[model samples]
Target: MDVSCAFATALDSADNIALAERLGYHRAWVYDTPQQSPDVWMTLALAAERTERIGLGPGVLVPSLRHPMVNAAATATLAALAPGRVAVAFGTGFTGRRAMGYGPIRWSFMESYLRAFRGLLRGDVVEWEGARMRMLHPAGHAPPRPVEVPILVGALGPKGNKVARELGDGLFATLRPPAFMTEHSWVAYLEWGTVLDEGEDTHSEHAREAAGPGWALSLHGAYEFGGPEAVRTLAGGKEWLGVIERSRKQRRHLAVHSGHCVELNAADEAAWYAGGSGTLCEVTLSGTREAIRRKLDDYRARGVTEVVYQPCGPDVQRELERFLEVAKSDES
Candidate 1:
């Protein structure tokens, strides 16, 4: 399977994109959490100008965050820079929506957005939100807006996947192969965790710093689905639940996602103190390089066309080098 890297979006993101290009990563997907980082389009535009071949786009675009014309215009600009390398992924805003105490957008709205956005990309004037809209960029201004970038959608369940089949060119999903997937589908599985250093302790401070976000996110997902009882499955889960519970200042969501995807928050760091630390490695791609390689083989065998690995922690360069090294190990 092809391998790609994603950053949680930062000011120095272009430098990391340049590194991913040099290290042979297939793409660089920058996150779109407006509350947690910089503007996704601006960051992507910078990465596009700085690199030559590595693909670039928001990992998943949140429909509620912008107008279709805005998105279609930005895609034109980035497509101008990268040509056939841009991929537009539509998703229900996870942290981006939830931090504001909102939930995922409806699939019906997803269908409408896709129609409007893709039509504008094709230079077709489409009516949206009460008026006709289209990209009017002059020849020198942007790519001729019959810009044909591939579209992907983030979907985990039947409702969402149904929309994906109707709208997107590919599927952006969590680790498992969704039931609808066939060998012909372009499935990109999003994975998390760090490749453990040889002899590194899973519970060590260094390991937590490297892989805590993946484990903590698991806790976050569980708690979102099953509440306090759910997080009790992890080490400090019970206590972490208490911490989040007591902080229900009508905005407990703010605390629940403080360090999402990028690093561990105080509540996240607390949950890794005991035997449960091993769960961090067990649940994610956090194993030795060989272990990760075999795990990747298992995914590729299952017909995953790509593994989009999101590496966390302070040292992005090391994370980038380690993952690419593991992905290319089969050739050696």
Candidate 2:
């Protein structure tokens, strides 16, 4: 399994990028959240110049945030700088749009945007205002345009998964199980962290604190119980109720502002973390090194292509080091 680091734009610095590269991480995934962190494109550009072989990309960029033409141009520019070391993962505006105070766009519109974006990247003439625009300089003179850049999709539900399978070169996901990828033959690149050994208490504490309660609750529930019921069960106190109430308020505010109807409740959050249809934790990899290895082996046995590790919490460096140790170990 190839190892990739999740560059938390909010927490990670240039030093983190250097550390990731030194730790033998193949890629650094910068998130696209305006409120959370730095600009993903700029960060990736800088990271490209910083590291030789480490690939850089947006874990998932929102189509609604920028025009397809802009996305195409930016991606093309990045590809020019990094050559074969860039990947673009596109998704319907969820986190990115929410963070930027933009409303969500329809799935159909996202599909159209991706089609146009891919066409532009492939050097095909895209119809814009009754005019044709093609990539001025193609990767090389080849039948398919030799850019060799892979377009990944952030797929969660069946509709998203179907879109990814139909249109994307790979699938980028966080909470979704590995079985979904196996069923579709899409590359499964999961996002989360793993810790092994002890004595890094300060680092672990930092990571946990940085991860926050929501992230920890989600991860704990996902790994332990497989679905929202588990999350609900684990968060059965007033603390969880407070979070649910806050989410409801947020949903109400969202509805008032954007008029987008969304189910908001503890159950809704649970359902989002758990598979919408049912609860299943058959593919979440967490816990100790041996346990995680066994879980990864199961995923590999099921034909999982990749597992991207995103370290969360307060002590990111410590968690990163632990993740590296596991990656370098015999089981990995």
lDDT of 1: 0.83
Q: lDDT tens digits, residues 1-332, model 1?
A: 78998888889988899989998999888888999999999999899889999999888889999999888888888998888889978889877788778888998999999999989989898999899978888989888758999998888788788888888898887744676655237888888888887998788776787778877778788777677787897778886776787785687888899988878777776676645577876678888999898888887777678788887778888887888888888446
Please give, for residues 38-130, the per-residue lDDT of candidate 2 as tens digits.
788877777777777787788788887777777777787777778888898887755567544455666677677777788887778888646
TM-score of 1: 0.95
Query: After superposing candidate 1, which stretches have Cα over 4 Å from the reference?
Result: 175-177
Clashing pairs in 1: none
In candidate 1, position 68 carries an lDDT of 94
Query: The CA-based lDDT of model 2 is what?
Result: 0.60
Error of 2 at 274 (Å): 20
Residue 66 in model 2: lDDT: 79
